[model samples]
Target: MKVKGYPMLASLLAVMLLVGLQTPAYGENATTRATWIWQTDLIKDGGEELLHFASDEGITLIYLQIDRQLPPEIYEAFIKRAHENQIAVHALGGDPRWALTEHREDMLGLADWVLNYNGKVSTGARFDGIHLDIEPYVLAQWEDETDEVISTWEQNLIMFLNQASGSDLELGIDIPFWFDRYTLGNGTSLNEWLIGTFDQVTVMAYRNQVESENGILDLTRDELELANRLGKQILIGVNTKEMPREPHTTFYGYGKESLNAKMEHLSSALGSYASFAGIAIHDIRNWQNMSSDVTVPPDEEEPTTPPPDPDPDPNPEPGEGDRVPDADPITRDPVVRGTYIWEAHEVIRNSQEILDFAKEKNLNWLYVRLDLEQPYTKYSSFVKQAAAAGIEVHALGGHPIWALEENRPRMMRLVNYVKNYNRAVEGDERFHGIHLDIEPYVLPAWRENSQQVISEWTANLDAFVTELKKDSNLEASMDMAVWLDKYKVTGQDMSLSKWMINRMDHVSLMAFRDKAEGSNGIIAVAKEEIAFADELGKPIKISVEIKASHEGDHITFYEEGAAYMEEELAKLPELLKDSPSFTGSLVHAYAYWKNAKP
Candidate 1:
């Protein structure tokens, strides 16, 4: 059925369902696609006009997918038209299953040809980068092929980028937005592998879009907030045309007006914290020549629940040059467990000390902060040693650069660098996952005001994690909040921890900052976070503040508190569920872990 003929309500729902990576909603401001595209996939005629319009409208990027190999002449003409119009061009993926599964060498070679075509089109063409929309495991490849896919992506793509690094070419990879947060069939440890490798990363964040029936802005806000937070140079996607996703016609795409409105709202919400470097328009096919008059309304409260994210990472290729040491392959303890501080960075500034501490106390995992300036060796070595001693390592990330509020493109470089270093230098067995410590407070002041800024922040985070997983065998876990269970923290305006964690291997809750009197004790609160994870069947972990985080105002839970908690923890197994369900406990800091024990 045509979109205009669909029930107004249904069409509205379709137009706004998953606008900002969160949910379907009313007339709230929409997030715009920064990198707009003239997708060849299922696109109608006059696709060039959409590219022209995007360029005229000052959109930053455009992508065109090639169905099968094209003749050089046809490819050159397409490239020339885009360049003549001054639009940036990138590739979109839709390889036939046969090419993807059986004709592996040919498929990657085709990608290389396209990549070369993109290069030959212009300097870097309109934008200085290349994009791959490899939807992994949509169906199975041979077990051997799984590793081959990643190996080829890295060897070919990274090699290409390195060759052009001196020439000023930019490169990036695109993946399903939910990969980092959700466990899915075709995911990869891409961010980790490509860190230091790619120029930027984009995440696709739209599906089932719709405006609220009441025309209120509740649900849309949540999604936009999520998209803004999840990826680097995130380019959260929103479809320009109104159409139903196949099979069910269940999910609808976004309209131009709604998307623009969402972008404006996101800009307002994120302010300077708004790292939304830009938006990714799904297709120019749907974008009409004229702009829409859709006005984003103010946001309202969202639904009590949200749609689920894929719930659940990577490893090595067989090689004579080196055989990866076999690992026992320990799954995360079902009980809520989390570690802080590792994922990016080169050296664990204080390693030997931290590992001894984690091992002695029986902690399940350790979050290691490897300073990016240092080579990966110091950090990678520490993780191997720690894992050998029966403790897991989780790489932690904090910005090495002081300017956190830089443009999306710039920040993406930092994220990619960190993730790439982790994968290239570290081992799959030594670490359980990459842990994102996305403390938004440090963002440039301009970003502090807008919630969309936070969404952008998250998108960048997700991009790094997703990309890394493409190359490695680890899972993706992020540190979220303890506040999600009950009360909302006023003015903070970040994605709800639950909302963000919906796509994670499990969420790690930093459950502290006691303000009100008579609140549940820290362990009680931690348990609450775990319970929620259990309810969702998503694994959960807690960062127990064995010591007070700061000496100031918040309740100080130092050694005395740690001991009290440690004693309580000794009895924790007796309180309820299976031992595995509890995972393991994470204490705050090398300083604190040094002192506490069960």
Candidate 2:
């Protein structure tokens, strides 16, 4: 034992044997933090920013978009740079439509591109894997002809899997968390088949919260177990893009600190299982914006499967206002108080009366349109008085056509005009936010071709937000109908309500019902929207109609006296005490309500 170099020689041999026998740990806490990067981001000078952002987020792998047009040298440089930082890059590209026979060659083209790139680059610059995000569910046939489409999807998947298996490259696929709900013709669940078929699979479990029935953990639990059984690893993805409204499904609303906390919770729940890899934030840009410190914990030896559903009812006995939390409790004071102020001229002339009425009613916000033609001095004076009375003013004026491409600039001009005035005016005198009342469904074209019109409308709004966000950071809100959740968009497969809510900072739901009680009343109509808003942590301002309507008794409070309205509104706080984002109630218009007869 005390011999000259014997101990040193034995230690060197042991180290060599350990190194030779050791295999990659595809187990719990042996996680890889991954992010997606669009092709445009990777080819431009901005690519460096992406790399820097990834490094900051502690990203171990990047699924970079494959750009065949990009020069080989650029790809090599990016891959080399990533590798130097100990990051693996996977060439990513795919389209759900490509699942068709006509697009089969193009789908294969992605693999060919990766193979070609790998051959061209040095060993250090080569891609570590390939990731395809071909979502076939959005296709029209998927809904109308499900069996055929599923078959086609299966065929294309098999072909792609075969090609990957034949090649030297490692392959991964992005799948919706609901894949477990679908079964293949062979009787295996789609998720199980996928985990069995690929080197890796990423579940798009994109909700911000990690708890709850549909949260990331619950959605991915099955896949995590299956992947472990199959001796594979899976990444759970979360979204970061800003949504139009709340039951916000992305981390954009959670902020960095909360996201970090939620990720820790996710790890705590899943890290004990074998095959429980780390979280993968959706795209690089959003992850960069998030800026969370990702820390991996020490691994533990455990079974691969998830623990049986944590006692289906965590609490068997019901308690007052007791329910399982969808997310961490974020408290906000109950707000249900405001009214619309129509007629710009009347508001300016009767400013004192409006202020007094608002104070008497304990209103906190006023939705009104601005008359820029009026003297700025007079306008500022009224707004200042309103603020002194503890009332926030939100400018409201938008036509359905404003959401069309041709009229978008005009709408933008209006937004810019408000921002310019705000910059010039004192804080209290300026409008708090812009409320766009552009109801796309009210347009004639929408009635005839709802899908196309709605698509165009949503795209227009997205473009407007893109431009508005570029120049102005003012709060922007939109008006929406409660029924919007019923209609689904063709290409997106999501409800119109969901699409719109994801685009706005917040939404004012037109829960215009005369009665506050009963099944067909204000609360019933607004229940769904309010629940959604609560989930997303987005505030919702429910509006009731006092103005006489051409519709019917059910939609307007015209005949219901002001006293009845107050009585009904009083019931909201108790009714909505459980909702995290029940901002409060708003009356339709001041002019109508001020003059309404009992």
Candidate 3:
């Protein structure tokens, strides 16, 4: 993962020192006034309005949130316009989970997405850099599992740094003013390390005052000094949004005029430091909405008025005094009826017929096999048509050999093919995800050396999921046998079933039994998996076989009419009503189910 042209820290520092005497040239080079655009969707219709505002405010840089769901053309148009206004746009994205090793793919995905996007776009529309705003301390685990969270946070950051290396895009991160208080295992301050590590560091000073005990200047002094020594650019950030708990932390009541004056004073105080790039407003929305009345004095210790309704937090890190309001819990779909389709070549030919069947069966999801050799246009029309009928199409392909390290290229071919296909197409036409059906146990290696095969399988799958997620928002899922709960992973404490459930966004458990209940029926077989998935807050899709099976009569629903199968499946929702992870069911396939007995 070593980037070919990545500069050494010392060499980068030397280059920075050579240019340190002059004002840091970012965008227009007029003391680096910047702001954040958290609601990037605004540009979909209001790009010109935003640019005009930026022009009037003399803003030089913008940290725009990355919304992959938004069309690339929206970004292209907005960024192109911003460039004309002399504003630099950096892609901004991150989450608390991104700090964990399990979610490293999500972090790296953002970087890869930007890199790929920049390559496809014109120079004027390309992003200037990537800015991560990951704050792991917000998670409850930070209170109880501090060491583990810290370890993973450091590891993920290193991985991100390595992934971003050799790229032309500048890499930056947002750190709280108090990061200097946290020390790494090596005893170096976290803020000091970050300042030296990244191209730029933006310290969230978030105080109305420029000076005072714990004011903006007081809080950012240590970071600014460290950045000066490391020869790194540092932007001091201030909040304009109302904070009910910490009234002094924001310029909400002070108005734009007061905030402007405070920023000017802050610039004067920190301007002497070579690394002091400029001031960054917390966000554009709040800054724009900030009252022009200047209700509170700039030197006031507290807000003169009660806080208004809280705005969405763009940099939420709840600490002792800075407590962010909890967001509403997310609810899952009541049921996700699904099926599998193996013959992908027929998709374009029989697009309407497939949609008709899917709608008739009320199937919301389909695992459609992907023929890599087939052109992307073959599936585009079918996928788009299926989407119109409220059905998601996931590209499916797998082989037993894909479980081996040597066969990774084969595995990645499917991933790359799907990724490139999605990039070429528009919304709904792209595959919703990749559904893997690799069953390594079928291979001779399984019996020859079970442990070694299991080890390779685990490594291969981990790489597959990681690579699949690195550039796209595709859901990584796989089919797991109901009995995998019995086999433990090579060295892990958990079973292979639990490992897969934890890793995949959702797993389709091949319970295969015709009956819904009984000692050895579908419900009983999937009980452990459903419970494990619920514990992880992931989903489980119980799959029943419709195709005739040579294995056993008990395994297939082919003997039973579609009416009888529906009768048994109807009991699942009521039986597993308490289990949130039971996201309905899937038939083994479309071919047999289509011609099954009524």
Please, what is the whole-model Cα lDDT of each candidate in the order they appear? 0.46, 0.69, 0.77
Q: Write the per-residue lDDT of candidate 2 for residues 242-307, one digit (tens) a residue.
A: 332222356653357667677778877887656666778877665565434321111122111212
Candidate 3 residue-wise lDDT, 316-373, digit = tens: 2213332113322226765888888877655856777888888898889999887676
What are the TM-scores, per candidate, against the unseen true structure? 0.38, 0.52, 0.49
- TM-score-superior candidate, 1 or 2: 2
lDDT of 3 at 368: 87
lDDT ranking from best to worst?
3, 2, 1
lDDT of 1 by residue, 1-598 (tens): 1122234423433333233234332222333334544335323444565556766656656666655544555545555566666655665544334224354554456456665665555442333445655565443342226566544444444334434343333455665444443321235344433321334455454432333332212223333344344322334455443221120111112234555666565445444323244556555544552235432112322121222211110112213422223312325644433345432322345566666555555655676654444655666677677767777676554431111333334344445555676657646435566666554432223123435545555566566556756766666766664644332222433224544554577666665533212245445555545544454456665455654333343433453555565664455445534423355556555544443332
Best by lDDT: 3
For lDDT, candidate 2 versus 3, the one ahead is 3
Which candidate has the top score in TM-score?
2
Identify the runs in model 3 with alpha carbons over 4 angstroms from their true place.
1-30, 300-598
Clash number for each model: 102, 12, 0
